[model samples]
Target chain A: MMAVTVITIVLQRNLFSVVVLAGIYSFLMATVLLALDAVDVAMTEASVGAGISTVLLLGALHLCGGEEAKPLHRPWLPLGVALVIVGALVYGTFALPEFSDPLAPFRTHVIPRYLEQALAETGVPNVVTAVLASYRGYDTLGEVVVVFTAGIGVIALLRRVPRREEER
Target chain B: MKRQMVLRVVGKLFIPYMLLFALYVQFHGDFGPGGGFQAGVIAAAAIILYALIFGLPAARRLAPDPIVEAMVALGVLLFAGVGVAGIVLGGNYLDYFVLDGDPVAGQHRGIFWVEAGVGITVTGVMLKIFYMFAGRGRSLDER
Candidate 1:
């Protein structure tokens, strides 16, 4: 279902529809998360990915050309690079720990301690919150910076109205 | 504007509560799976919903340019200021012990203030970007 929407996003020419398609994509991603028994992740994905990101992307679309982005040039270099990445990812999937493996090495690592003491340390019931706020606070801080930078970058890129051309 | 009474009334009823819930999410991130980013977006969305229903001009009026600009600097400053406090208290960056007389309490305090900072900046950017979008000559209202 989502694949159709995403492919439509890529293939369609209407920029507004593209934003709508991205919004649908987020909803689908949230559903996928719920199917995997990751309730908290699904919730966060729905709230953040669907709600905020869709708004931002739509707003950006409005500020710029509200038209489907046209490719600059059909270059095979980027296509080849993307193909290589997809190939590598497919190859790597074979080595992945079987889904729901109780004895997976990843399940028995430092996460156990973090999970055990997460509430005591941060007073948060949702382990994801504890890890994000306390255990990996630095990364969250970095994430904030990244968002800030993206806003700045977007404004800088779009505010180019050729200085010499006076306004009405 | 569509004179559909339901959307107009529902938007009026829902916006205030949505803003309140956003604040709650921002402060209660420690106890839940939400934080500054989510809260800011929710708050921005509420305002956006208002714009979508009431009018874009009204929304832009509610949040002006200067407010958005100040918020950007304030968020980054607040985040860095907490780290400075930690440095002054003989610890590494963002140590949070220096925020208050007590270190543990200070960590909580530090996290709260920093997250609030993040929320402010995010909300500001969202509103500002929306304003820019709505201000464009895409619609008939803007001359």
Candidate 2:
């Protein structure tokens, strides 16, 4: 189903339908994440990917118009490059540890400390929160700064448009 | 969109719950599967829904441009302030262990503030981006 959605999106020329299909793709991805037991990730995906992005895309669509432009020519070079990159990624995955492997490097070395000591250290039952907000507080702070920076950048770029353009 | 009565009613009904759920996710994150980032996005989505149904002007009126812009900076300040507080309390930067006499309690307090900061910034940024996109190409009077 995910593949079908992607194919349809690639083939479709209507930007509006493409945006809606993209939202559906995000919903399907969120469901997959939930089934994998990554509930935190699933929630983020559902809200950010499906909900917020869908709205943002529509707003953008209003500016750019609804029809995708026709390609100038067939793109055999780009397709071959994409296929090669996909093949490389698939080959690289074979070297990764098996799913849920008990002896995975982090599972043995890093995860035990968090699982065993998180409650005592942070008094938080949710290890994810403890890890994100306490153990890795600095990293999260950096993430927030990045978000702040992006917001500033957008405001600087977009707000500069002369309001008098309406008069023209 | 202005004449779509069904959309307007359904949106009004759903928006309150979305905002409420965003708050729930923000505070309940310590014990549940959500956190500030998710909550912030959810809240922004609620506002975006209102904009879609009722028109952008009403949404802007509800969440004024200046206030929303301020939020983007304010949240980062809050998060950084928490770390500064740790230093002032004689702990290392971001050292929650010394925020209170009890290290665990300090951790709790620190996480709460940090998450709040994150939530605020995210909500602001999302809304600001939405406003920029939606308000593009509009007249000054319309904006």
Per-model B-chain TM-score: 0.90, 0.95
lDDT per prediction? Answer: 0.75, 0.91
Number of the top-ranking candidate, with TM-score as the measure: 2
Give the 10-residue window scoring lowest on summed lDDT in candidate 2 chain A.
A159-168
Docking class of 2: medium
Clashing pairs in 2: none
- Proportion of native contacts in model 1? 0.29
Query: What's the residue-level lDDT of B73 in candidate 1?
Result: 65
In angstroms, the error of model 1 at A100 is 3.1
Interface RMSD of 1: 3.4
DockQ of 2: 0.79
DockQ, all candidates in order: 0.41, 0.79
lDDT of 2 at B13: 91
True contacts kept of each: 0.29, 0.84
Chain A TM-score by candidate, in order: 0.76, 0.93
Tens-digit lDDT string for candidate 1 (B1-143): 54778999999999999999999988887776677877888898899888878877677678766777678767877887777777887878877656677655676777787788789878877776666565553342333
